[model samples]
Target chain A: MLMMGAVGLAIARIRDLFAVSMLSGIFSLIGAAAYVVLDAVDVAFTEAAVGAGISTVLMLGTLALTTRKEKLGGGKSKSTTAFLVVAVTGAVLVYGTFDMPRYGDKIAAIHHHVVPRYIEKSGEEVGMPNIVTSVLASYRSFDTLGEVFVIFTAATGVLAILGRARRRREDEEADEGGSDTKGAAS
Target chain B: MMHRKVVLRVVSKFLIPPILLFALYVQFHGDFGPGGGFQAGVIFGSGFILYAILFGVETVKRVLPPWSTRLLLVVGVLTYGLTGVAGLILGGNYLDYNVLAHDPLHGQHYGILIVELGVGITVAASMITIFNVFAGQSGGD
Candidate 1:
């Protein structure tokens, strides 16, 4: 948790977008480690892969297309209100967590829910040893389908935006190869 | 360029295959492990992303063009939707795996496997597509 705070602080203070992105990735990786400590391995796996690996690469790609540093003193900043809002929200969130059940509280409200049924019957019903997989893929398959559709939609949106920009660039420059795209790394 | 990138290129080449192999293992073995389509897809996608970063976008694009990645993403979504439809056609409720096989237990297994596979396909394709498009642009927006 302290490591996460350190990374977040570093990211907040950094004016270089590249370093900020790197710090954010480190923050995510630490968060993933916390998930593992909490025994939420599946979530940890997703967090590490998506947050650390994929997000870092995507951020670098975005940086490749944009300026490396944050522009200072852009317009009249509303620092006071922003600070107030952030403080209030953070206070509220921290206060809310205080009321949550302690880790693995035996008689926690969440423990009394359908989790028991999922644990006991998932093996026989779904015939899977990993209850999380059976729960996610079979008992609640519709939800997974919805998640997939969401990703599909997001990709479509990105494609639509990029396609137009590429076309406009081509029209202006009429460069067939667009070889400049590979010029940096190569 | 090649001289400067020789170590990066050689190391990634050696690492990429195993990375992809682990992703497939996660995708197929989720029922017994702590990973699934979501995790596996990102891992798989990152392997390619690593290759693209070190080897240049053009080399990766030659194998996985933007248009094909788009089609793969669409196909992934369809596979999941159609699996649900299959459950309906088999006289069960939508997404009901009881009718997928003779044995209801095995049916659930098959249903989960195929559904996760659908998720894996779409997710991996989407990641690749987004990365290629974003990095493929020649200049800043």
Candidate 2:
């Protein structure tokens, strides 16, 4: 956790987008390790795969197509307002955590609610050893279904925008795409 | 230039199959483990993305054409929605697994497996398609 926090700080302070992206991947790997410590292996698996693996590759792919260094701003910065907003939001969020149950508190409301029924009866009812899968697939599947469509919708949006990019690339290829590809390859 | 890098090509060739196989294992074995469709899908999609990185996008396009990714995306959703419809047609509530088999227990098993597979398919297709969109254009947009 401390390493993750240090990586986060480095990412925030870095001006180079390429280095920042790399640090974020490191941060995610550390976060995945933390999740494993917390016994959320499924979440850890996801964080490690999506954050450390695919997103890092995609970010590098993007960096290949763009400037590595961030362009310095010429206008006056809004540091005061941004700092104030961050401080206020951070304080309020910390305050909000005060009312929450202590970590792993047995008396937590969530443990009292539908959890017991799932824990006690899920084996007999669903006949599955992995309650998480049973919950995600069979019990609250409507919710998971919605989540899948949400991903599908996001993909649709990306395709629509990038398809235009492809067309523009094709048109440019008619002119000087050869030179561009040659430059990138070398 | 990338083709000259023989180590990347050889290593990725060695690694890709195992990664893809692990994704399938995660998808099917989630009923007894700490993995499920989402994680499995990302792993599987990244397998191809790794191929693209090592071999380039054109090679990957030959393997997974754009139309096929789009079709897979739709087919995933269709499989999921149709599973629910199957339950309803079998005289249960929407997404209810009780009527899917001879007993409710086995029904839940089949229901979970099928639905997780649907999620896996859609997610894998979505990730691959999205990555291709971002990486396909060599020229910056």
- Docking level for model 2: medium
User: Model 2: per-residue lDDT, tens digit, A1-186?
Assistant: 888778988986788999989998998999999999998888899999999998898888788877799877634457667778999999999999999999989898888879898889999999889888888898899999899999899889989887776787678887697788888999
Q: What lDDT does model 2 reach?
A: 0.89
Candidate 1 lDDT over B53-138, as tens digits, reads 88878899899987788888988899889989999999999999999999999999899888888899999999999998888784
What lDDT does candidate 1 reach at residue B67? 79
**Model 1 spans > 4 angstroms off:** A74-77, A172-186, B139-141
Can you give the DockQ of every candidate in the order shown? 0.75, 0.71
lDDT of 1: 0.89
Worst 10 residues of 1 chain A by lDDT: A176-185
Candidate by candidate, in order, the iRMS in Å equals: 1.3, 1.4
